[model samples]
Target: MNETQSYLTEVHCLECGHSMPYRPDLDFCEACNAAWLDARYDYSRAADLWRPGLPGRHVSLWRYRALLPPVPEEFRISMGEGNTPLIRATKLQASLGHPAIFIKDERQMPTNSFKDRQGSLAISVLKQRGVTECVLASTGNAAVAYAAYAACADIKLWVFLTSLVPPEKMREVALYGAEVVKVTGTYDEAKKIAANFARRRNLHLDRGAKAIAGKESMKTLAFEIAEQLARAQGNHTPWQAPDWYIQAVSGGIGPLGVLKGFTELYEMGLTDRIPKIGVIQTSGCAPMVRAMALDREQAEPVIPQSRIVVLSTGDPGLAYTLLYRAQKENGGAMLSVTDEEAFAAMRWLARTQGISVEPATAVAFAGLRKLVAGGTIRNEETVVVNCSGHTFPVEKHIMDDQMVLDMKLSQQAKSKEQGLTEALRRLEEQITSVLVIDDNPLDRLLVKRVLQSNKPYRVFEAGSGPEGLEVAETRAPDLIILDLNMPDMDGFTVLDRLKANPDTAAIPVVVVSAKELTPNEKSRLTGKIASIWQKGAFSANTLLQHLVKTIQTGTPSTAGSDVINALQTLDRSIHKIVIVDDTPADIRRLRRFLEARRKYQIFEANSGQEGLAVIKAQRPDLIILDLSMPDMDGLEVLDTIKLEPDLRRIPIIILSGEELSAEQWQRLDDETTDILPKEEITPETLASHVDRKLS
Candidate 1:
């Protein structure tokens, strides 16, 4: 086969099957109205083109040249990408009791990502056509890959990136001689800017997945994984497909190509079966997962909420439709893991398997664990997870202390200088709304002063957990600098409530406790907050530095919050119980009984009106309500709460002084609501009923 030769046939839309002859200028589906167009190959000549002289080749992605996108020999530049190791995760498999688990460590690729494959083909083809200038936008990895290849191809390239991207990533692109323009907006905004730049310069635009080279080059991963698995069994045995093939997704180009590769191989008598394609996503930006869960054919855009900025592609565009259909047909799961889980998995992989993966890769590992635990992936089945790249180190030295130029999108701002100043003023107004949740007056005042002295922060104080939650919603602060030792409600419980509420989950949190955290407390805080300071032990400067980092990066504080805020604070994995009654004796009795029986975090409201307020604030797992109240009746409270879509899911337990009401019984849910007579109820009876309802 010729080195630059390929069996390339056409470019077609994955959505509308709109086809055209292979053209370098082709990007979207054009008249077809889709965001992705993939390369098609003449499969009749596939065996001769793909299966020739396998024993001795370049040992890089170009080894299978005829199977890749075509470019002239002189333009086919490569830094020895591909040939990444597929290691058996023995410890991980054993820990989870799985038969076979493999990690396709794509971190070994030239630019330390699977993206190198895309760049090798994409940039080569562009270089062959004498393209001198290009532009693209990326969260991180793709920008680095494209920049490196463009540099090698001697093509000038410009990369637009979101401010949430790590400095390390920006520096990586800059080191490859690409002009890096950091935008203070979402990834989608960055793409628009890059597109505008490309149009103005008449430059080639490669918006990552929008290029056919991605589909063509990424298929090589599927090919290599098949070949490697067979060779590992020793005697050049037949390539066998694993039961599950998994990858962490952003724009979702990798899986599209991978699924294409396996399908072609199976048709061409290479592999026996197609693997179930699994795409993992961060919970903060899981449009695909959300769509699949609702059985939707297309994905809806989500606000980029997670701190893992690298995997922060909120809109997958038409790629979601393609992936969704493939997943539905192939019998796979699209799952999302929390930022906390992803970081924890990153740590786990490093400690147990000696694998240092970025939080994006960690999302895949976490999803694999979730699948295994959920029985979606059986232990007896084989699994292969793509460890896409090295973790985001977030080192300051990489950029030499140079922050990105904060791109302003406001139409009112004219000049760059005025725009930046206005942006900073607006950001200051938002970030300075720091909420200090501490019981100690002196400590709260000290923290308020420390924060204000540095940035003139407008601080709000809350002496208890409930007060803090109320203030958190009302003030809507950018960061919560809190102490853990509150007497009214422990700061931990407050942390749980803050996280559980969608209104506050995206807010960054920092711990500034006078008391040193215990092992249990440390474990709880590890992936939740950016860092915990021993209040007076650390210098104010150090605290501010950590605060700035923890508070998230973007145009405004709301663009997304700090990396340590990547910790995303605490999750409400524990159940909360709320007691509502006008009678103090009944409220105290029930609270005491539940507190002694189980360690459920209990909150109380003296009347029905106060109870409704408590439920809205707390979002408790279970509610104990007294039917008769002076302010509002229990049934009315139930009706009001049930009307709210967000609060309707919470279970309620009603305590009535007397019973014999069929109409009231008809209004309540059998599964979520249970009634009991106060005169007849006992601790044991209440415990049994509560346990059953909770179960």
Candidate 2:
């Protein structure tokens, strides 16, 4: 193949088999809108892409550019993704009584997951095609991956994430500059809103299977595996194929890409045979596995019941039929593992191989273990397992404490404008203070430089553990960055003493050291430390990001604490009250009663919309809202107020004479809002409701 020429022929419908010349604008088949499009490459024009460990050849997924969608040098977007390590799982193989089990360690990917390949390819194509903005809905990793690549390409992106995804994952994408809109419903529901938003805004919508370039990116893993295997003997070694290829699926995109890759290898005379494929799913949302169990082409959409959000793609779409046919043709199997089993698999893999993978990836290993025990996978067969991605979400739990102002299920439509911006703004305003307790001057200076480089942090330093404790006790910084080796007093003693001391006990510590901890040391430090980083293993930027997170983990943030304090003193500190009513007479009456009850500063709005504007701008302590209003009604205003994180926290008293219907009562009661009858409203009746709500 020519260096710059792409052999990519066309994109075709998997169901209808209708093909069209590849176009960046087209996502679905023209003939069959329901079925997703799959990319086709004219393999006769293709040549060998494997030049492993060779100088001047790219080390990333872009190494196989001849087979991938072509992009100009200027438009190419990459973070050196792919080229992940494949380790022989010697311990796992022995335990399973299998001859060979190799982990295609996608944990080594740049974004710490295989989805980086998709991001790299998809963003490169989008940039090459001059597409400026795009939208995606992902349970977790994919959103982060795509956002990172899009950041590199300088493309605007909005990501819709499933609500169940750990808060850390949402924060990760936001860090990558993606506008994050979280769905309070299922993963599929988020997809609907995201796709609609993309169309409404006239931007690219990247959906699984339909995202042709992203789907095509998965095949590069097959290429790398082949190249790696060939290089093991010699770079010139003829193609050798594994007996089995297995992976966990969300939308079943990974295996579909692998199937296409291996088939192409066979057609191109690189591989002698295609491997039998195995796809795994979490039992909580295993539509394809369920369908495969009954020999059905597809299964009904499942409501995701899994706590493992990343693996919960409830409906597999065109992926079912395409993967099903491929599996059947290749003598493969589809299986599901429970969350418990996946968690156990995560522990097992880490215990045996020292590989900590996310629960989504563990689902495959769990299924692999089950398959081998059931004799579905023979002991003599060589199996390759795709450890697709995740360690980031599993390790971090800091997003909860951060200023993550998430929108509710009913608030998604309104979120497109205000939600993500609010979240990012709040994060920027959050300040964390750090104290460094390292005896090494260079290391202490390094840390101080990194922290100070970021912004607004009050960085304190101590040369020894005792001095550090003294400073920590007096200053009570938000977090401490400590080093293990110190003169006169060691870090462990400092940790014990700090935990024992009441004043400094709650301060989180991040240990940065050159020393490698043993099992006993690791166990000792497990609950004591927020995180550990080896001195040279991390960059200054990475250390800064993690240090900030360490300050936030496990405790309510500084901002959250301030909010709590503010809420506690509302009755005494807050003086502003907004009376939202259409009638000037009613507003005057309510204001007079409120002012007499307490020394409150009264604000007035003539209409519901006007009231919302005033309430938002003034951020009143309480709201006295009239139900009956012209134009925007009280219900609409209530919805808008409750949808906003800042506005929702304020106390609302519905002082209206209007007889509310049963449904309106339900909605109001659900919000737990206080209601006072306008007809019965006197100084005493209104005061009781206002006092109770404010108090």
Candidate 3:
């Protein structure tokens, strides 16, 4: 490498602080057993070389060549990834009662997302290393970006993705000539599969945040924001960081990289302060938000339920070690928004500001609204929200539902007879039809009640799989809620038959089952089923809310809209409860008792680790723990829970088989809601204690 190319001095492990030579294949630090690595630069020399008025005609990220990973100019791959517009959101600011609000419109970047910045740098670096093939796992946008950039660099790319990814995204990725593997599980699972594939093939794996080049490119966003803000203020300062920098995160690499950029500016005396960063996530699958709320250093993995596909990273690799510390040190806060709030914000932006964004991007705006309303953000502070990407081919999934609702409401408001007739015709043509296929009458009735409570839809019932198939063929319903435990035919057989027929294959199917699906059953439903709802894991209102959104968005796999309205209309409140015990009998007893009331959304875990993960993911209102487990006893779990400020507030009841001594009782008393003997735990007494504590 030449002198300028040698700007990258070394790569270091963020966890163990061990440094090593920069290599394309070295992803993890062996010394520390850490997956995250940071690229160190000769910043002293970089500061001297980079000045306010450096001569450069290029406006792309390469403008700061001294700071980015070194690559020969001839080998660099650039598609105008940086220097995107920074628009002042005057209307949004006025509406939110904030003084200054600006939008860093990353949607303007090539490939229509911030991923382009990383892709451009990453692909260029790989090319320099003479790497011919690479693989990665992405929800959507990143795949498209990498496919495009890698193709430009004449490199072979393999992409692994979950089946939940939108059809449009898959088409886009395939169109770029990249080999795609559609995994039959969540994004986290897809990542694992991709890692295994890379290992077996000995191919270069694009390790997202764990790769130095991947995160290094994202710092340009921060650099651009500072420079643009300074220019907007008519100031000649080299940098001007915002009072607050907000962005929605999945892996959290973007925000961490941006923070690093600001830190670089501060070291160079170009900026005075590091902006207080704000991270946003969907409430449905927000491990980072949960960790933040609990005041924990690490975020536990979750099975993500968010419909915002790009933000559904169940495990944010390196976030706890890198991004969490950045947030804490910078005096930042994390916030979460529901699908309803994000959709509302999406609609508001489109109507008022004429900015159409995907749900993931709108999440940041929703967070901004929440912060303003909660007084977490002052009115006078200058804030910048990252408008990361726009919704296009996926636009139908984001806007069509609201459009349909708006059209119906508009037609109803018209006074003309022609308009009324037209509205009636539209309703008749577009009315959603649902089919409930279950052997149990109670289950069918429950499905009907939930679907009907939200909006008017024609509901059809089938007592068996054969009858359900016949009705499905005849009625051509928009959706089907299938139960696995049928008398004559199981749900898997029904699903397979439906998929075999071209006529019925297009319709979406939601699996609602009480029985735990076997591996074979799960495999059969992988890409076939749109969603799976455990029978007692959700309340009727929650089901209704989800169904409405799924119908509206035309994405059966996505989470539903806000349930605040549904909650208001429901007769009884439903609270989530998690039971942690090694005994299956104990778990079944609690579940049986809780299910009888139909007021608790219950989850179960056999080990303390599993229980902790579930608690972090679900944020249950109450926890029931068995004190004497084989590994990681209840007391240890209780101590871990109590350490988290947010989780400590959740009431926990301990059920111990052994009688505790005076000191043990006192120690337990200080942290737990109550400790009752397992032998004394009757259904009635347990129910009473639960009701009182929850109340």
Candidate 4:
């Protein structure tokens, strides 16, 4: 197949043989008007093309750019959104008496959900077609992601959701500059209203409503998992893909997408096996599960719906399609878990893996447990349970003390950031004192309990960031654990105070917060933060491990000698490198180059504010600033750099492949010393310029 137009050449209807025009704005089938639209590519032509170059593309869903629809390169927006970690579900396996359990961590995506991929692609298509506004009706995650990406693209977004939707989810969506409409009825009804509104306003509609395009967006997950498993098992045996694939089902786009990805790989002769997929649902409103059991083509909700609201999808048809497809193709089945079961599973995941998941995600874990207990799933088959959401309930749930201990033991093997030696040092250093700032009494108590596990550490608590800072000033502790959302001056302010003050700055502080952070959030928590461990990400043992690693270690391995040797081969003058674009391709290329050239450290910023922070902190000898950014313009950044006395001395290079006008050129010349157009500057060329500048 030709790599350029492989999986997406035309839009075809699943209901009818007729094809539709390839317009980004036109989502459904033109002929039958079927809502589910499949992308049809010239497969035979694509097959003629040789295997794609691995390690050649960005670490995103765009890595499969050849198979994606016709979105221009310039308009594609991404934020380290794809290639989520596929981890061993050791705790889940033990609970289910299954030896080979795994998890696909979609919760780690940019917007704390798997919807980042579709949202990015949707925004890209909209941008390509020059559409200025878009509206989406989502239960939760998808709405938040679309809002975030639209905000990034500087486009207007309207999110139609139900009043029953969680306030936290609403806050996240609204924070991203989206206009939210809280409908009075079910999500499906809200979606219907949104559709009508879109038509009435002539707003650009994302074809995901019927599920085909949204389903296709998830194909990358299946491809990646298959590839990862293949690499793990090697060529010596018959291909054994995952024995079962389990995930929470709402619109059911993700699971269906996974199935499609696997089908594509199998067709491409990459693998001959496919996993038996498991669809999990909350017992409160399990329309798809009931439909699947009855072998029904459509879905209808179970009555007396339980209030574990996150997985509240009453529309069974959307869910039924995924269940039906998975069962037919992979010999899969559906598992419905009760509200209590899901809540318990969430606690179990938290205690065991130090991962906080909401009820929607926990349903998968609960279902997997049920499968194991019933002996429906075998102990030997490799199973992957998808952790779809990171949002745990604000209120703490009750679990026996023994349960926590057992769970922790089950999850002891996972490696988060590596560095066993560093972990040992930190633990041994003896945290003689501890300080915590959180309003929740339970949270404070839990943190204290975790901190007190090591007798050498003494725990102290603060109600707010300001109080925490005051405590730090008076009684400097060995470490401070801070929370982001506080009543009086947030954690950022407290962090600033600590970093600014010589007394408290050196003490390494871990940020413990409930909020999901973006790349900008990660970047902004720079100076004094040793690590940002979300409230759910850290446990007593994990904290202990970190302390042992940090304080007791002799010297940490920055990189191995072999890595240093590879870096030394590069020009020494290139001590620093900067990535200018928000595009995934550029970020991937620059990151890969810097990774190989280990001596040259890498930094990035989505907007001008982030870029400036990197510049001030790293003080790189070279800089590459993006011409276009949402918050601050590239020209403005250039102006700022020229104005700063110290920053002006650093040599600047234009890394963008974009062309500058004669007038723009004149303006740039007046501002900077060098303009290394991306095309003109190879890695070697970049190295040469660095050599010239330093000499």
Summarize candidate 1's per-residue lDDT along 450-509 as a digit string, tens digits.
Answer: 776766455777777788898787557788877888888887888888888998987878
Candidate 2 Cα deviation (angstroms), residue 329: 0.6
Question: Which candidate number maximizes lDDT?
Answer: 3
TM-score of candidate 3 versus the correct structure, residues matched by position = 0.56
Task: For candidate 1, give the lDDT.
Answer: 0.77
Steric collisions counted per model = 6, 0, 0, 23
Query: What would the TM-scores of all predictions be?
Result: 0.58, 0.59, 0.56, 0.54
Query: How do these models rank on lDDT, best leading?
Result: 3, 1, 2, 4
Write down the RMSD of all candidates, one decimal each: 25.5, 18.2, 23.1, 22.3
The better-scoring model by lDDT among 3 and 4 is 3
TM-score winner: 2
Candidate 1: misplaced stretches above 4 Å?
28-35, 48-53, 234-236, 391-404, 411-695
| CA deviation > 4 Å runs, candidate 2 | 32-35, 47-58, 233-236, 389-405, 410-695
Over the stretch 356-446, how does candidate 4's per-residue lDDT look in tens digits? 8877888888888788888888867778777777543222122111111000111232542233223223323332567787877788888
Alpha carbon lDDT of residue 532, candidate 2? 68
**In lDDT terms, how accurate is model 3?**
0.78
lDDT of 2 by residue, 453-561 (tens): 8764656778899988987875577999888878789888898888889988889887788776666666566556665677786667756655654464432111111
Arranged by TM-score with the best first, the candidates are 2, 1, 3, 4
| Each prediction's whole-model lDDT (CA) | 0.77, 0.76, 0.78, 0.67
